[model samples]
Target: MLKKQVSSAIIIVLCLFLFPTIISANTNEQLELYSEAAILIDAQSGQVLYEKNSQEKLPPASITKIATAIYAIENGNLDDIVTVSENARNAEGTKVYLEAGEQVPLLKLVQGLLINSGNDAGVAIAEHLSGSVDEFVVDFNRYLEEVIGVENTHFTNPHGLYDPDHVTTAEDMAKITQYAMKNETFREIFSTKELPWDGETWDTTLINHHVMVRDGSYEGVTGGKNGFVTEAGFTLVTTANQENISLIAVTMKTMYDNQVYEDTTKLFNYGFQHYETDTIDMNSQFVDSEDNQYKTVENIYYTKKIGEIVEEDVTTSGKLVIKGEDGRKLVEKKLELVTNKEKEKQQIKNETIYQTDDNREQHLRIIIPISLIISFLIAAFFFKQTRKI
Candidate 1:
């Protein structure tokens, strides 16, 4: 009895040490962030790993240029030369100093707009793309809503100058960054630390304003952007990749620049250290109460803490939901019920019965002739017996 008790204790200890979900659930706690709004998401799956007031509408400041840059890249001809308009030169706040009538490629304007946070470059790009900034606003907001799937974001200008109505959420900003990062041109420009700049009145190297990427402050830093306005405070977005996993972190309305960076770093660390992608194979099957089998048509990946228990629930309508231990949904996949081809084949076989009218008629004829022969033989025997008597 003593030996058996010791063995059971050892087994319990081993189980406690082996499972990651059990360890994570007991040890992990949500990190506190300094920013008013922040979110961390898996770049591949778009799953929110952590958030604090992520959907709160706040002025995005100059980070609004992220949308402007990507829009220009997708819509405007980068090689086309743009003649700087008077409106562009007179634009206020951080600028590369474009002189009136200065001829520059749209690509250079984009680089200046993103790298230097130049309000002038944004206007110029806007004018070149859509004839005027007013016209550009219409298309910009349309793209944000229709193409990018950001419902809460609104933009009034090409540069993130403070506007009362211009606002975005941390979650929405993260989504925009995730979408923008897919473009090679945007990624190259966004990740660039410094580039040679030759302007009509000014000549210098344009350096990226975001410290995490430009200064190599963080490991695996891929790209980043920063924005600041008196009304908006400090806002920052950064993307990092490690061990084949990519993440996006966005912090908005922090009191200080350091706070934004600190908050962003904390968000990234929490995601990388505690969470991982769990994949559900499409070929896996589950049976319903009625014995109908269902399967996913494509593989699904979701982010969750290591060693956390994930539950699967399938509704009769074929919605497959993956939930965390606390019953919060992590991923929802649409599944298709398996088709029972064998049952159909069996039904078809049963319907194709071999009995025909001719076969039934032949059987009836054989039975009648045999019956007549037997009767006749019986009658003959009876008659012979009577004669003997």
Candidate 2:
């Protein structure tokens, strides 16, 4: 019985050694996200707060208008009056009821497209800006991928109508929305809940289609767009500002409309309650303990919890690395010494970092020798102690 008890104790100790409990900072317990894909990001800092299958490509529906609106505002002359073609008038799905040959300002079309979720306005703007839908699609995709720096999104239409190949991820949509929210014009149009419309066929007050933004059920929402089709389900993109921090949330492929909003709200609440965006002024000089002055290549933002402190240091190679509490890198920038010195005078404890495979060899060169010396010292100490014994 004594032997059996000892063996059980030994087995329990081994199990405890093999498995350790892990604690995560995600306070909402990963959040019960209902949408198939969801992502929340800091608008100013572009830091990801929470994500659920964020990179999975899914149909974006009308949130694609966010991209279209920004593109039109930047590329097309918004003041130019564009003559509506028959193709625009005939555009399927939601529309502003623009009549064929009706002249409308490019800016007005963009407003109509975003406010009323007007498919016709999208087509009109697309045709006016690029001369044809096919050509517009090529340019739009390029802008989404190249200009905005999103990789998974591939849009075939400006209006986000169902095309088998027209798909974007929730993460990509959030990034696109973040980029659009930077422009004052796009922000105004996006946030406009109600606008008086004087169109050839439809003369009424155009209201934002997103129920949450239009009805004011959710506070702090600056602007939002929601969409749905049989193929894509329900997709929603919302931008909100609270406590001076801007947040963007995107949810896609939800079977029910309410589920999408629920997921978005959860994401936003989790982000706002836990994290805040802060920036490092590259213009400011950083002085080390040894009095070496350094400056960053550019200003950069990072998101962290209210109480968590992020660490930053300049490497020997003049690289600035910012890391979270878990030692995960948030961003890196090149650093320049104010004195134009060729060498770094001090190395922090972070020099032992092996964050990436590419740096494994470099870190190993530093770690292996130190480990060997420590082991040799320990062995020598034990030998002396044994001899004394």
Question: Which residue pairs show backbone clashes in model 2?
Answer: none
Relative to the true structure, candidate 1 has a C-alpha RMSD (angstroms) of 5.8
> Could you tell me the C-alpha RMSD of candidate 2 in Å?
17.4
Top candidate on lDDT is 1
User: How do the predictions measure up, each by TM-score?
Assistant: 0.80, 0.80
Candidate 1 wrong stretches, greater than 4 Å: 1-22, 25-28, 279-299, 307-316, 325-327, 335-389
Q: Rate the local accuracy (lDDT) of all candidates.
A: 0.89, 0.87
Global lDDT of model 1 = 0.89
The residue ranges of model 2 lying beyond 4 angstroms of the native Cα positions read: 1-28, 287-292, 343-389
| lDDT per residue as tens, model 1, 1-389 | 99999999999988878785566564256677789999999987799888889999999999999999999999999999999999999999999999999999999999999999999999999999999999999999999888899989989999999999999999999999989998999999999999999899999999899999889998988988899999999999999988746899999998898999999889888888877787778788976554567898888888776667898887766778888877779898888879555576777776655446557788999999999999999999999999999
Candidate 1 — which pairs collide?
20-307, 21-307, 21-308
lDDT of 2 by residue, 194-281 (tens): 9999998789999899887898777799999989888999999999988857899999998898899898889888888888777888
> How close is each model in CA RMSD to the real structure?
5.8, 17.4
Number of colliding residue pairs in model 2 = 0
